[model samples]
Target: MTQRTDVVVIGGGQAGLAAGYHLRRLGIEHVILDAQTAPGGAWQHTWDSLHLFSPAQYSSLPGRLMPAQPGQTHPDARHVVEYLAEYEKRYELPVQRGVWVDAVHRDGTCLRVASDSGEWQARAVIGATGTWTRPFIPAVPGRREFSGRQLHTVQYKSPAEFAGLRVIVVGGGNSGAQIAADLASVAELTWVTRRPPRYLADDIDGRALFDAATARRQALDAGHGDTGGVASLGDIVAVPPVRSARDAGLLPAKPMFTRLTSTAVEWADGTLAEADAVVWCTGFRPALAHFASLRLRGTRGHIATVGTRTVDDPRIHLLGYGDWTGPASATLIGVGRPARDAAREIASLLSG
Candidate 1:
C-alpha cells in the first residue's frame, strides 16, 4: 500500500523537525520519516563530554527556546537531546520513527519514497538527513593495514577507554582538536593535521562562527561565489576547553603522516610514532545516498540546488546539509530559515 501525503520529510532531526513545525503552521499535510527508534536524533549518539559552542538561547529551533543549562553557558549533548525530544512532542509533529527512507524515485506528479516500512507518495520531498551516520575518514595510505583500534568521531564516547595509551587524532578540524584536548591527560596524545589548525582570536566568542556561517550563507544565496561555510575544517573556535588545552601547551600539531606503517604512522620527515589507537576526525559528506535514484546529482556529487530546491527536480528540496542550502543549515539555530522557506514553497506549490 502506498501512503500518500502532501509533503514527506526524510529526516526527523533538527532540520526535519524545523520543517515540520513550519509545515504544521501552514496547515500542510506532512510526515517526518526518521530512522531512529526514538527522539534526540544524532545528539543521542554524540560523546558524553560534547557541548555546543553556542549558548542555549542561540541554539533554539523555530518555535522553542532551549532552556539554559545550569551553571554552564553552553549545554551538553544530554540537554540538547532532551530538548529535541520535548520539541517534537510539544508541537505534535507527525513523525514516523524507524522508517529509514532508502531511495526516492519519480512517479509522474509525485515522488515515491521507498523506506523500510513502506512507500510514501508525496507532492514534495525534503531531504534533511544530516551527516552523523556518514562520518568521514580520509584515504591516508596504509590506514587499512594499521594495527591499531581505529574509530571515527561518531563512535567516540569518553577518554576512559584510552587511558595510559598512545592515541593519535588525525584531522585539523574542531572535532580533532577537541578529541586531542579531551584525551590529553588520559592518553599519550598526538595531534596530526594537514595544516596547522587555525583558531579565532581568544576575545571572539563562539557566536563569531555562527555569524560567519550566516554571512557566508547570505553571500551564496545572493548568487555570489561559492565559498565554504563555517563548518569547514580550518576555522576552530576558541571554546573554553580548547583554549585551556592550547594555553596549557597540551595541544600540539605534528604534520600529517605520509603513511601508516603496520603499527605506526610515518611522517614525511621520516618520523615514526607507534599508536594504540587512531581517531579520524575528518568531517562528513552529506548523507545523500537515498537521493541517488532521481539522477539529480551533478558532477560535484551534490544536487545542483537553488535555495533548497533541486535544479534537476523541482519536487525535491535538499535542506539542512550545510550553508550551500542555507546559512548554518546544519546547526540547530541555522536550519530554521531554510526549513521555513522550503515549507512555504511546498505549500505554494500544493496550493497551485
Candidate 2:
C-alpha cells in the first residue's frame, strides 16, 4: 500500500524531528519514519557515559529549549533522550517508530520510499538519516588478525565492561577523548591518533563552535574570504571529563600504530604494544544506503546540494549529515536552519 504525502522524512532523530517541526509549521503534510523502537532517536543508542558538548539550554530543537537538568552543566544522554521524547509529544510530530526504510527511488514525479512498515510516495523526500547507524573504522592493515575483541564507539558503553584489559582507543575526535577518559581508571589505556589531538580552549563549548560556524557561513554568504570556523579553534572541545583526564596526564595520545597483529599493534619506529582490545571512535559516515537507488552520490560519497535540496534531484533534500549539508547541521542545535530551508524549498517546489 502506498501512502501519499507532501514529504517523507527519514530517521526520527533530532534532524528528522527538526524537519518535521518545520514541515508541520508550514502545514506540509508529512510523516517521519524512524528506525528506532522508541522516542529518543539516536541519543538512546549512545554510550552510557555520553554527554552533550554544551548545556541543555544551548542545545535544543527549533521551537523548544531543552529544560536544564538539575545538576548537569552538560546533560547526559538520558536527559537528551527525555527531552527528545517529550519534544515529540509536545509538538505531536507525526512519527512512525520502528520503521526501517529499505530504499528510496524515483517513482514518476514523486519519490517512493519503501520501508519495513509500508510505502510512502511523497512529492519531496527529506533524507534526515544521521550517521549514528554507520560507524566507520579506517582500513588499517591486519585488523582481522587481532586476537581480542574489536569494538566501535557504537558498541561501547561503560568502561566496566573492559576493566583491566589492555585497550587501545583509536581516533582523534571528541568521542576518542571522552571514551579514553572514561577508561582511564579501569583499563590499561592507550589513546592513539593520526596526529597529536588538538584541544580547544577550556572555555570553549558547542556554543562557541556554533557561533564560529555562523560567522563562517555569513562571511561566505557575503562573498568574503574563508573564515575558519570550529576547525580554527581545535578538533576536540575541552569538555570536563576530557580536560580532567588530559590535565592529569591520564589521556596521553600516542601516534597511530602501523597495523594490527594477532596479539598486538606495531608502531612505525619499531615499537609494539600488546593489546587485548581495540575501541574505534573514528566517527561515522552518513547513513544513506537507503538512498542508493537514487544514484545521487558522488565519488566522495555525498550528494551535491544547493542548501538542503539536492542539485541532482530537487525533489529530495538532505538534513543533519554534517557541515556539507549545512553549517554544524548534525549537532542538536544546528539542524534547524537546514530543516527550515528544506521545508521552504519543498514548499516552493511543490507549489510550482
| C-alpha positional error of residue 69 in candidate 1 after TM-score superposition, expressed in Å | 0.9
TM-score of each model, in listed order: 0.96, 0.98
Question: Lowest-lDDT window of 10 residues in candidate 2?
Answer: 300-309
Off by over 4 Å in 2: none
Tell me the tens digit of each residue's lDDT in model 2 across 295-319: 9989987689887888889998999
lDDT of 1 at 58: 87
Residues 1-352 of candidate 1: C-alpha lDDT, one tens digit per residue: 9999999999999999999999999999999999999898899998878888888998899999999999988899899999999999999999999899999999999999999899999999999999999988888899999988999999999999999999999888778888888999899999998888888676655456667777777777688975565655346767788889999999989888889978888988888999999999989988989989788888877688888888988878989988778877888988899999998888888988
Candidate 1 residue pairs that clash: none
- How displaced is residue 77 in candidate 2, in Å? 0.4
| Distance from true location, Cα of 157 in model 2, Å | 0.3
lDDT of each: 0.88, 0.91
Q: After superposition, how far is residue 297 of candidate 1 from its true place, in Å?
A: 0.8
Clashing pairs in 2: none
